[model samples]
Target: MLINLSGVDKDNYTLSILKSLEKHNSGSLKITVVMGKTAPHINSIRQFAKTAPFECQVLVNANNMAELMAQSDWAIGAAGSTSWERCCLGLPTLLLVIANNQRTIAEQLQQVGAAISLHVQEIDTPKFTECVAFFRQPENLAQMSEKVVRLCDALGAKRVAQHIEDLTKNEDFANIRRATLDDCRQVFEWRNHADIRQFMFNTDELIWENHAAWFAKQLGNPDFIMLIYQVNGVAQGYVSFTRQSENIWEWGFYLAPTCSRGQGSRMGRLALAWAFAELGAAKIIGQVLPHNIASLKLHEKLGFFRLPEKNDVAQFELSLDKCYIKKQFHSRFKIE
Candidate 1:
């Protein structure tokens, strides 16, 4: 689902893309544009299309988004926030990376072979046509679609619940226990790092005093549960869960700034497994911005299913009773 956070400039790129689509005008290709939150840009697009084909349609709201994307072959979407929704649905895309904030995500998606990122300067009529034509090649489109299908097969919610199950199953992997108040000091360091903050919600660098206040407030919230991860008895990272309600949890985590040899996913899975099995919850949800490719992949790996989307952050869920563990338990031991 494309969340039009482009604000007033929403239709500029979509219109350009549609103009290119007209040039190709393949009867087989069906396209739909979903406009959200009163969709101011719809009128602008209407003005440009003199005659609308039966295949091209526009929709509003989250409910229609999944249906449209499911029915269509591919999506040409904004790069920043809407990207996750596309990934969550396993929809391959040709991205228009419209903002500076989106560069990291665009590069990551390209690295993983999930998307092609186009600059605004490179988004003219010819380039757009070429992208559409290139993907229309059945083999190329299938390969790209396969990547998305694998990455987003389950909507992302279920993966998280399964991860929690993993953690609970291997309780010994809870390497760090009895995290003290001082533990936030270490997490704060990573939170304030340049590379870490770049992908984060904040733009400016973090000040210790201000950062500490935020950390304390987050830690203090009864809804917020923080757990530190360690190896060889040293603090390496942390995992956090927000008890969203009796039935839901919002989760996030970060490893130490320098510790990037793929250990984060393992730790995440362990922590997630713990949450679902031990925390006594019906479902676990994760809200991720579109740009976090690693996190997106991790979510996919853990079986979190994405909801039909509406906003910048894609929503994924995992139901405990339906998770893989339950299925396995029922099969292996016939508990069910």
Candidate 2:
């Protein structure tokens, strides 16, 4: 594991982390800590590293920060601009909010599963130890890495440069189209994927026969609309709307299992816009399982208001006018 405390005056916090690590350390665990050149307690850290039970390295202003991060399984670091750098490298992190400004960034990242956030005061608690253990699990590490990489893929600057160059050109980054028979197999596979099925109302592994019959029937229904969200001609997500009444529809959506992160938010924006403009929907309703925290957060981000809960399920609704207002204010990314 990597612990980067460079540029932050958190030597005591670093030692606390090291103490926790000592208690959990086996011969197999290796730790690398990077510190600024002018760090006050560098000598103390170096002494601690020399006698650590497990392999530990203390480096001053390491020139190989990116290399170290890329090779590590997970990290514990301060929440700052470097958070994006870590995200770009797909590093699962336990973020410590060392400043008031960083608290929101840490919390937001945690909410999206991109990173785990903890107050600096919590470093000595059992929660810190639990977080350390959490990263020890391969599955948990992989999941967090996937989410983090989605937020930033080391292409932010390049994307910005390209956007500036193409400012005058009318280009569509995303679009939605009606799903057809050709999408049946792919859709079936995505629906049955464990990640997708977990949040679904029906979590049973679906049989191909039932799925095929249902897909065909839904395709034939006039009141049911299934659309595939595509980016540059590749399908990345699936969305469906079931008309409940005039101008009112109940909707569901999920991204492809292998789709990149942030695509869900883009897909949601495009799908909602299409429903309001093309389908003439005045209001859209969505039902989510209580445990589906990501979906609930997404709905809230899209300006959906929560209705009363029913049978332990949470429901949210967004009206056309409110969506229009949100789109107007958030016009940085055009949803054509």
Provide the global lDDT of candidate 1 against the true structure.
Answer: 0.68
For each candidate, the alpha-carbon lDDT, in order, equals 0.68, 0.87
Question: Per-residue CA lDDT of candidate 2, range 1-336, in tens?
Answer: 898854646446788788777876545778898888877877888899999898999888888889999999999999998999999999999999888989988999999999999998888788988998898999999999999999986878999999887894675467778899889998999999999999999999999999899999899897999999897788888999999998999999999999987787778887888788778889999999999998999999888999999999999999987667345523544444
Give one digit per residue, the lDDT tens place, for model 1 in 19-123. Answer: 666666655665566666566677766665446442566655557566666766677777787677777777778887788988888888878999887876676
Model 2: lowest-lDDT 10 consecutive positions: 325-334
Candidate 1 TM-score to native: 0.43
After superposing candidate 1, which stretches have Cα over 4 Å from the reference? 1-11, 24-28, 50-54, 153-336
Off by over 4 Å in 2: 1-172, 325-336
Per-candidate RMSD, Å = 20.8, 20.7
TM-score of 2: 0.48
My TM-score estimates for the predictions, one after another, are 0.43, 0.48
